[model samples]
Target: MVTRALIESVLTRARERSRLLTDSVDDGDLVAQHSPLMSPLVWDLAHIGNQEELWLVRDVGGREPVRVDIDALYDAFEHPRSTRPQLPLMDPAQARAYVRTVREKVWDVLDGHPLAGSPLAENGFAFGMIAQHEQQHDETMLATHQLRSGDAVLVAPETPDLGGTPEIDTEVVVPGGEFVMGTSVEPWALDNERPAHAVDVPSFGIDTFPVTNERYLAFMDDGGYERRELWSERGWSHRREAELAAPQFWEWDGKSWWRRRFGTMEPVRLREPVVHVSYFEAEAFARWAGKRLPTESEWEKAARWDPRSGRSRRYPWGDEDPDDTRANLGQRHLGPAVAGAYPAGASGLGVHQLIGDVWEWTSSDFLPYPGFSAFPYREYSDVFFGGDYKVLRGGSFGTDAVACRGTFRNWDHPIRRQIFSGFRCARDVQGEQA
Candidate 1:
């Protein structure tokens, strides 16, 4: 499955998405932030390219490539994320051309070699890691574009009037039982999804849909930020020290409201899922609404239900490819569809839109399950858990549909708000008695 063509496909898509950001000479300091959260477009392009060469070629060869300046050109973690790199900057045209050259060279070298012979060489693992890493950066670039330029696209559904919230009187109940919690083996699975094992989950109720912009607005109107009682200790601290307000793109236009999306402006959609909220924000909203966020296991169980079969399916919509009619992924609609647009993607218990729309926040921290072990790349899972990271479920508007499998696990800081993130509420088996 690891082919040069596959690698090239990933690289080409990454480059195309990166180009979506329009950086001008007058934009001043092309570098945005220095954190690992996102990379400056200039730095992102070269860093990713160099990483491909470093792991696939240089590391495999036990030597650096001949002409590239590995140290001076590609070292990004050393400098702050906000500081624009002083290295030779390239205009979009020149930068893109160089990227193509590097990509071709790397793919050629990889294709010609018999890397599968040595598992420890980590050629296969390195290739997948870098490919997925670039894809993630692409998503981050989309978010950063929305934040900086006020121009991120939010799309309406292809077929409108698909019904908003259904008339369900109560949350869907998931019976308690032993369930496999993590991933086993697949064509490509991140290290965090590994060491799959059984866990006993108590019965519980989960919201049929993710929290919507209309619902979150109610929290804001009730002075959700001003009231510290509804926030967790850490959430309260983050709110105070950071002076957090509304979600990243939201703007109060006096009598009404608007939001900046994909380099364009639009009136906020009240019924749509609230995008661009951090874990802290989602948790606060849940608390204000007198509900709680679900754990990742609970999310997985709820998403496996198939109403038609009364049994679990591998994905929310059964074991099938995500067609355009089912979910709002792959940049097809340009951005998000209304939360209820994908009824077909619902879990067995009638949980709608669990796979793709916006990634839902979970109450759990990012952690390894029992019997955890490191993958070829040690930095993948172990390095991220110790930080203040939280887990997210489903997939976002910009997430690659191929990468958003049901068992796939994603995580980020609770304070980050630039991504197309959202959350749904859940209750304990005892109905808040727990």
Candidate 2:
């Protein structure tokens, strides 16, 4: 199904998104580091171009290198985010010109190359990979905009409201059994999501909707942060060490809580799923609610498995791609739609907001699936396979559809709160108190 036209369109769309995010701010802002957690926006711009050139122009097309001298400068592994601003990164004008030149060459490679034979080119996998890569950075850049300190620089239409909260059930039972966990047929699936396999997940009760701001506020009012008993040993330690109080960007006014969204201050919408909570924070909140974070498998089952059909879907709503009606994705809205807003996007078992809103943290660590193998490069996924990273399923509002899906996996350090992340709670079906 991956045709030359489709590949071109995907790549074009990715570039447009990348440009929109970068062009929103001035060159000075682009070159400055908004957070130690992320690289300067200019670094990301050139890095995106460098990766495209490395993978497509050189590796796939066997074309001559473009600006081989600057490769080291943009090599992400060579420079950490904290040190990136100190490095001699490309100026905005130079970075823009460099990427433009590289893209022109890439277009020639794409038009001349056949989309077959090798695994990288077969079904246009490499092109799709590059598109996904750019989109991932686009999401990262959007997060940088959120972290930036200044006036609001970016804007998007508000997410659709379901008028009022829908009268939906609060929880749903995934009568789980064996389900296919990963993908073998998805043309663009990355190494971590490859080699489809079966996983037997026990039945569990998962929240019908993600934990909303209203619900999380209840936890805060009840002293969720102060109660050490609700947190794991390490989580409790991190909570105290970081002096964690509220979710990142949240501030308590004299009357109510307000949050900074992309440099704009607004009252925290009680109906929206709370974003920017760390994995530790999500864990603590789940414990306080008398529930537990679902394991990676449980989250996937709740989002993808249809018990009646004994089949797994490509997304929560089915095999179709995401749209405005399905989920709050592609930065279509600056924030999550009100919880229970996307009724049509609910999973087979009636779990709502499972696909997008915020990246939902799971109890599982980032680990390889059964019969996993590194493809093309080990640095992509193999390097981070361990307990230090917790698996986060589903994509956030800032996530692009090209880089997200039912099996798509995201991971981060347990204490990372800068990334847009939230959680839904689950409990075992058998005699587990909730």
Segments in model 2 whose C-alpha atoms lie over 4 Å from true places: 167-169, 431-434
Candidate 1 Cα errors over 4 Å, as ranges: 1-8, 21-38, 59-68, 71-76, 84-94, 110-115, 120-126, 150-170, 305-314, 431-434
Inter-residue clash pairs, candidate 2:
none
lDDT of 2 by residue, 67-152 (tens): 89889989888888899999888899999998998899889988988888899999889999999999999999999999899899
* Per-model tally of clashing residue pairs: 17, 0
Q: What lDDT does the true structure give each of the candidates?
A: 0.71, 0.90
Residue 11 CA error for candidate 1 (Å)?
A: 4.2
Cα lDDT of model 1 by residue, 286-367, tens digit: 8887788999999988886444455445677787767776777755554566767777777767788888779899989998
